[model samples]
Each structure stands twice: as C-alpha cells, then as structure tokens.
Target chain A: MIGRLNHVGIATPSIEGAIAVYRDLLGATVIREPFDLPAQGVRVCFIDTPNSQIELIEPLGEASPVHAFLKKFPQGGQHHVCFEVPDIHAAAADMAAKGATVLGQPRIGAHGTPVIFVHPKSMGGVLVELMETPKGDHH
Target chain B: MIGRLNHVGIATPSIEGAIAVYRDLLGATVIREPFDLPAQGVRVCFIDTPNSQIELIEPLGEASPVHAFLKKFPQGGQHHVCFEVPDIHAAAADMAAKGATVLGQPRIGAHGTPVIFVHPKSMGGVLVELMETPKGDHH
Candidate 1:
C-alpha cells in the first residue's frame, strides 16, 4: 500500500538546534527555512537528503499534538514515519481493514498532500503516516 | 553525508507479529525470513518497500542492545534510522569532528555492510546509524 519513505518526522524542543546538526554537522545542502503550521500546532522544516528528507517538528502551542510527546520525552525523539502511498483513500481503507486505526480523516499534511495517521498502538508502537503522493511524481 | 535511507530499525518484542503488519497489512511482498545474529544479541528481519525497508528487530537475550529499550517502552518503538553513506570511515570522522559521539568503530552491520552508530544525545534523541552502501549499488 505504501510507495516510498517520504520523510521521517523528528520531534525536538528546538528546531534551530536540530537544523544545525543537519546543516553544519551532516553537511546537508538543502535545508528549508522553518515555517509554522498553526492548524497543525507545530513549527516544521525539511532537510533534504539524497533519497528522502528529515522533517523536524517543534510544538507550536500547548494544544500541539507533539506537546505531550515532548513532555514525556523532554529531549524529544523520533515522532513518526511518513510513507508515500499512491492513493490515500485506498491505503487508509486497506489499513483499516487490516485492523489499524486511522486516527482521523485525511487532511492536508505539511507537504500540502492528503495524509492520514494510523494510531501508533496498532503499528507496533511506531506512529505511521500515510500520504498521497502529489500528482506527477512517480514513485 | 547520508546517501539514502536504507532502513528504519523498529525494536519489537515479537518479530513475528511485526511481520504480519508489514506483510499482510501494508502488502509488502519481499519479507525476508527472520534470522538470529547471536553476536549482535538480536533476531532480525527485513521488509522491503518500494524505496527503503523496515527492519524488525527483537532482543535475543538479556544482553541485547534493545533489551533496555523494550524494558522502558514495553510496546516497542522506532529504535533508530539507518542511512547509507558512501564511505563509513569518512562519515565516522566527519560526525566525530562535529561533536557527534560515534558509538564505536565501524563494524559489519545486518546487511553485511560496515556501519557505525551515533549517540541519540548528539542526534536530537534520534539514534542514527550510518552504513556503507554495498559496492556497485549507487545511492
């Protein structure tokens, strides 16, 4: 159902600090400037790699979904893994049929793509996000 | 200096159960048979996706590296992200020079490729593994 590893989301207390590691340390050339997604309640940025990208997410407010995660982890950690799917609707249905919990209806994700999150409890504790690949991109 | 995402390491208490999710739920066709690596103190299997892979790892003994992780998490979780690099030695030196703690010298990893791990503390709490790509495969 999944196509490719779109990006790996990493929760962090500070996006700037995370950027430094990927930019200065890892020598990543394509580090997008950080931006806020108030609706999602998180500040995000992408660091491009040879194959995929790393998404750094910081809690934007108390209501941020990542807030509780950061509270328990404090130091922050791997938040989730997003996989590209050819069809979000079909993927969601397939996963649901296989006894996975679709957290919510498909919503516009950070990539401006339709995405749905599967409850981590049903994914062996690994939070999983299935995203619809943008039109024209062949995986 | 990362080449491509070779695999995502998921620490699970039961590799068999994990395989079902990837194989049956996700419709993964290439699910490698589980094998024990006593030296690494773990049993491992690989589920290949279109772009990368999911490595299901289960602690083999009390001394397994993932033993403590499972004890703390209980439900199992994403343990680390492994990236392919062109040269393992150079990657290690570069990371070390940037203040990232290289866990130990490069050693043969699950894919029979040389690999080194960077401490989670230095990587925004995300344990990172750098593996040298197998000869002849371009990242």
Candidate 2:
C-alpha cells in the first residue's frame, strides 16, 4: 500500500534556475546542491519542506528521459509524484495484477532505495513512482 | 514562506476512474467521496496519504479552468501543486517583491482556506497554489 507522499518531481532545463524560484523566491531554505545521477540521466536537486520534498531534475544527456519532456515544456513542469510503498516487489506484483504497467524491475532510485514506476496510462496520466519505504523510515 | 505540501491537484475527466486507480489499484485506503465545489468550478475528491492528500478534480462546466486543460490532455494530468504558507497576505507580498505574478487576490480555495496562485511562468512552468496554513495544524 502507498505510504507517505514522498516527493513531487519537476523536470527543468536548469536546476539552478529552479532553485532560485524555490529557494530565494518561495523561501525554501534547506536545499541540497545539484548532483548528477548518471543512471537516472539527471542532474538533481532537492528542496526539502516540512513534510515532503521538491525534486528539480535537469536532463543530464541527450538520451535522458526528461529530454523529451523538456522539449514539450520548455519552461519545464511537474513530471511525476512518488509515494512510499512498504515493499517494492509486492507493489510491482500489485500493479501487474491490477493491469498497471511497471516501467521495469525495481531498481535503485535517487533515494538509494528500490523503486519502480507505474506508467502514466495506468495512473490516469500521472507518472507515479513507487519507492520502497527506506530502512529505518517510520513514515 | 511555504510550509507543508497541502496537496497536489490532479485534473481528471472522471473522479470515479481516478478513485479506482488510487484506492483499488494503488491501495490508498482513506478516501473522501467526491463532492461538488461550485465556487471552484470543479468536483473534488481526496485520497488521503500518510502525509499529504491527492486531490482529484473534474471540471464542472465549460467555463471551468480545467475544461481547457482536459481538452489538451483529454486524459487529464497533474494540474497544480498546493503548499501551505504561514501568512497568505505576507506570502502574496513576498511573491510580488520576488516579481512572481500572483493570479489574483487571495481567495477561498477548495480547502476553504485563503489561497492564491502564482502563474506557471513564475514557478518554472508549474502552477503553484499558496494556501494559508489551517489553524492549529502543525506539520
């Protein structure tokens, strides 16, 4: 079952520009510096809030998945929402049983935890990432 | 300043279908039945997660803002992200000082709280709604 609302992903052309908006303008103070996740094909930054996080991601290369998204939305936009699940493999099975398409086998996500994506078609046009509840995470 | 993520507003053509995906398929257990919010020009349903809520919205009339979004997406999509701010008036002033466009004066939102929207042009092409934190609610 879905647990906490983990974070909302926003695909942007520049993480620094997105940081300016979220940090200086919106007053988000605790922010993580941009870091590249070659496997995820993104230069990612995290803006932490009281409850969840705002993930700002920029395409790291031409083959990055967000490359096409950035083309469609030049100024970038909300890309997906991630929720914590108790178990990754079980969640994948649940998705399959319910006729939802899991993007691939559970893989390590930016959080360093196992995660899988349910296609937007199955989630009603929302790309939903199911992240296994991190070890020691109470929520 | 932004506080908790109040909710993510998802525009959907059918609240029932969205509910089926969130509740039955995704195992989201606590769900509030759909209700009409005529002033907001949409019917709303809430899927409660441990931390935040997922708001599913369906345009109530042709004049509804989401009506235009549905035309472009047909299948609906993530419409906007709402965050709680400590003081609505101050937040609006801050947005103004930051050169962010506030759509209009703070008005009552679906949550019955004063909320104002920043144009997508300002929030990195993400429509952001700032709502006054509900009374006595601690994140």
How many clashing pairs per prediction, in order?
Answer: 0, 0
In model 2, what is the error at residue B77, expressed in angstroms? 0.9
Q: Per-residue alpha-carbon lDDT of model 2 for A85-131, expressed as tens digits?
A: 98999999989998998998999988889999999998989999999
> Tens digit of lDDT per residue, candidate 2, span B1-139?
7889899999999999999999888999999978998877999999999899999999999999999999999888899999999899999999999899999899988777899999999999999999999887765
What's the chain B TM-score of candidate 2?
0.96
User: Individual DockQ of the candidates?
Assistant: 0.74, 0.91
- Which candidate's DockQ is highest? 2
- Candidate 2 Cα errors over 4 Å, as ranges: none
C-alpha lDDT (0 to 100) for residue B29 of candidate 1? 84
**lDDT scores of the candidates, listed in order:** 0.89, 0.92
**Which lDDT tens digits does candidate 1 get at residues B103-130?**
9899989999899999988888999999
What's each prediction's TM-score?
0.96, 0.98
lDDT per residue for candidate 1 within A1-139, as digits (tens), equals: 6778899999999999999887776677888989998978999999887778899999999999999999988877899999898899999998888889999899889989899999989988899999999998854
